[model samples]
Target: MTTLLCDADGTLFPSEEPAYAASAEVTNRFLAELGAERPFAPEELQAMTNGKNFRAAAQELARGYGRDLAGADLDAWVGQEKDVVTAHLRTVLRPDAAVRDPLRTLAGRFGLAAVTSSASSRLAACLEVTDLADLFDAARRFSAEDSLPVPTSKPDPAVYAFAGRELGVTPDEAVAVEDSINGALSAVAAGFPTIGTVQFVPGDDREARAEALREAGAAVVVSSWAEVVELLT
Candidate 1:
């Protein structure tokens, strides 16, 4: 493949937990505003919404709580969550030699792009904090939330398709590196050869998570960036 479409969040860095932890307050407030049964604790919320974005996760839980999200001020909630979570992520994200070294090698060999379901600003923050910003240019960073006209989440291939068109390539010409089932589904559905990794998943859950990614149409699943580099190079 000529281009490497790398997913952020769980794939690039372990930002899922802390990002979700940051979202807890806003999510709980959203739940209460919707008159749901009770507020969700940070860990509980993270466990429940593991790989989803705020809008998707909130709506899914709202259904369980007998609330309709149709007319909710979703923009407001999304904005608030982004504000809190981005700030929290900046404090927690750090450079990891494990991912950075392999990624640096890969960047020299392929066109590296940041493809994520996060807002572009948040993606920038994560990349910056994790010492990965230089590998991807601002033009190469595409976000499903901020880059797409409709702002949809993963498992919807609009963002990937859009990236291909913008980058002058087709799906088959690119390799997708994703860490979650939905993320894998998105890339595969868009016709990219996907490599799924559970590197950021907890030790006990990695195997099961890898299986899920395989089922989602990832060509193969890996546990670390070293394996990723080995396969690509």
Candidate 2:
């Protein structure tokens, strides 16, 4: 059985817009309070935040404005951004309808598991909001924050490798679905045949991003969940 170990953000759910919106809002507000320059462009913001955690993103945002924020300043900014996003998570995060049917179809054909970098509570909210909680059960769902011992970030294969173990499958018997370059690297490096989704990337840059993902070790690049299902099926 090819266990489907999927990412929640950008894979099962629509997370890019909300994430970017919150990042932009937080960045601009922080800059204004400090009387710094204006926010970075969307592409710059994407490059900074797409693959990094909140602290990294905050630090990058500060660096973009010609400021260096570290230590307590950086951590406080990251915390503020996270708090803002968490406050609006339920309103902003949504599931792609295109993924739901495909997931339902694939569930019977293959083992399904959700491997996410999201905090467990946020993941639960996202799943519940999308009515997808039932699709992945407790045992099948793996959150990086599920346990303190588990590393809580990607581009480190620990989470993907752990998911394969919990699913009782080897990398060759599974597939990893991802939308970001770092996520693809994590899965592919862990020995899963990774599929890159370009749905979250801007349409103009998708080809470039697809090429990047290909270089990052995706077996294929797809534009939507439909293509993902077609490839998996």
Candidate 3:
């Protein structure tokens, strides 16, 4: 049976609108506190923030601000933003039932796992909210916390590799479901058959992103996780 490695954010749960908004608010607050002008608009920040872990995004923003903020400051900033974002998220973010049912169906036929850039704690919260917390084998949940060295952030193959390792499978035998270009690329790089979910319709860029992933070797680009199940099954 093929082992399925899925991305968490835009793949398992809907894009966190509240978290994105809170990120903008916190970023603006941080800038104001640093006595700096807003360097990027909310949309721009959101674009950068997507498909990245909080710490990495925070460090990138710090560099953009010329703050050289690292270590504790970066950690604290990420922690604060997560707390603020998750509070708002608890009410709004929900799983796509369309995807969940297929996952339940597929689970009986394949070994299912979640490989995400999110921290375990945050992933746990999302899983609980989505009612998918108990569906996965506990050993199959791979998170950023399991990332080694530079933290196995996506677009890099390490995260997918870790998930495959946990399942005792080769990446080639795994099928990865992702919603972002980076996440799809990571699986492709790891030699997994990758399916990209186009969660947003970003006009010209949407086609461009899909083309890029296809060029980078994604097996297919789909609009929903249900398509992934159909393709595999």
Candidate 4:
């Protein structure tokens, strides 16, 4: 592959669980405002919307209640969610050599870009905390929320397509590393040979997660970044 489209949240770092912890607060607030009957616990929300952005998750939740979210209201909540999650992640995330070391090695052989459904600020904090920011240029860090003409979230291939055009690479020329079913679906939809990694998934869930990702069109599912390194390098 000529390029590597890396997913940031659960793929590049173990930010999902903690990020969700913070997001639940904001999400609960939104749910209350929407007049939804109940608040979702952090894990419940993660299970419901692991690979999607706040906007997408909000729409899905609202739909279940027959509540159509106004565009402006959704947009505002999305921003609020990002701010809260980013702040929480920055405080909780720490550098991990397991993640940084392999990507550092892989960087020599491939063009790298972070392509995610996260807002730009959230992606930036992830890269920064993991000491991975230097590996990709700001121009190479593509966010569905910040980079698209029409903002969207994974399970939607728009961001991946946008990255391909800007980077001048076809799916045949690049591979994607994603940790969520929706994320794998996004890359596969864009025609990339996707590698679904479950390194960040909880230990008890890894095997089941692998199976789910495989069903989502991943060429293979790996347990760690080292396996990813061995396959591509």
Candidate 5:
């Protein structure tokens, strides 16, 4: 049977704006704390950590400011930023109502699973908030916390591969729907047919962002759930 593996952040959840804003805010605060000359632009900041795992993103942000963070300091910084971002997410994250019909339609034809870079608690919260808890079960849900090394995040197909195995589906029998460059790369690397969604990108930049996702490894780029429903069906 075909399995539809969906991403959480910008795919089912409309969290791009809040996530980007929170990251930028936290990064700017960190830079100020370090007495940096300038903060990174929104695009630059997001591009740096968009699909990266937590440790990697934190390290990159530190390096951008020429800070050699290690041990407790690094952990503290990363933790603080995460707390801030999580708080912001709590206030704004919501389901993409536009995907409701598509999800319902596809449910009849394919098994569904959620593959996300978030931890278990966060993922659970998202599913609950979106009323998608019934569509995904614990066995089929894969999160960053589920990774063997404990924090192995995306762009490293480990999570996707694990999800495929857990769901008893082979790469060819699964389709990954993603909304970020890294997310697309991870799915493609895992050998799933990948669809990139531009729903989270700004209207003016959708074309460029979609192109970037395609370059990153997505087989197709779509702007709406209607298009995705058509393509998959």
Candidate 6:
């Protein structure tokens, strides 16, 4: 049977606006508590945080605040920020139930799995919040604790291979739905029929990233989960 592997963050949930806002607020407050001034806006901080790990993003933000923070200080900042972000995320994350129905329908015809860069806990929270937890037959959620020999993450294809292995399917026998460039590239690189779902269409740059994914060998680019379901059907 064909398996449909899906991404979680931008694919299942929004771009984490409320979480970013909370993180920024906590960051500013933390800086003030340390007798420092805020350096970046929430939006700017959000951009810096994207596609990066907690420590990396935290250290980057600290540098912007004119502090050479690393080690425990960076870790502490990230921990505090995470607590604030998680609280806010629990409220503001909106899942597309429209997509969930289609996923359920597809599950009857094809195996379904969630393959995401997020830690299992966060992914589970997202699935629970979206009421999509029951739709997936399996999930290959990655975390820092996973001790794979290779640095396997999105855009590397190892994560997709791992998911396919767990689902008892080959990459070519599966379809992948992804929102980010890295996620799409990972699926394509793994030889899956990858579809790029454009969650954010920023002006003319819409086609740019999509075309880049296409050039990297994605099967198609779509704007919605409906389109992905249509292709699978």
TM agreement with the true structure for every prediction: 0.94, 0.81, 0.87, 0.97, 0.86, 0.74
Question: All models: lDDT?
Answer: 0.87, 0.76, 0.75, 0.92, 0.78, 0.66
Model 1: per-residue lDDT, tens digit, 11-53?
A: 9999988888888888888888778677778888877766567
Candidate 4 lDDT over residue span 1-233, tens digit each:
78999999999999999999999999998888778688889999999999999989998988877898868878889989999999999998998889889998889899999999999989998889888999989999989888999889999999999999999999889999999999999999999999999999999999999999999999999988889899999
Q: Which stretches of candidate 1 lie over 4 Å from their true place?
A: 63-72
Q: Is candidate 3 or candidate 5 better by TM-score?
A: 3
Best candidate per TM-score, number?
4
Candidate 2 overall Cα lDDT vs. reference?
Answer: 0.76
Instruction: List the candidates ranked by lDDT, beginning with the highest.
Output: 4, 1, 5, 2, 3, 6
User: Which digits, one per residue and each the tens of the lDDT, describe model 3 over residues 134-154?
Assistant: 777667888764445555467
List of clashing residue pairs for candidate 2: none
Task: Rate residue 12 of model 2 by lDDT.
Answer: 82
> What tens digits encode model 5's per-residue C-alpha lDDT throughout 118-201?
766666776777777777877778886444565677888888988888788998788999998888988999899899998767
Residue 146 deviation, candidate 2, in Å?
4.6
Measured on C-alpha atoms, candidate 1 has an lDDT of: 0.87
Candidate number that wins on lDDT, 2 or 3: 2
- Clashes counted in candidate 3 amount to 0
Error of 6 at 86 (Å): 2.6
Worst 10 residues of 1 by lDDT: 67-76
- For model 1 the TM-score comes to 0.94
Candidate 5 worst ten-residue window by lDDT: 144-153
In candidate 6, what are the lDDT values of residues 29-126, reduced to their tens digit?
76575566545577776555543434545555567667777666655776676566666667776667667777777887887778765545566667
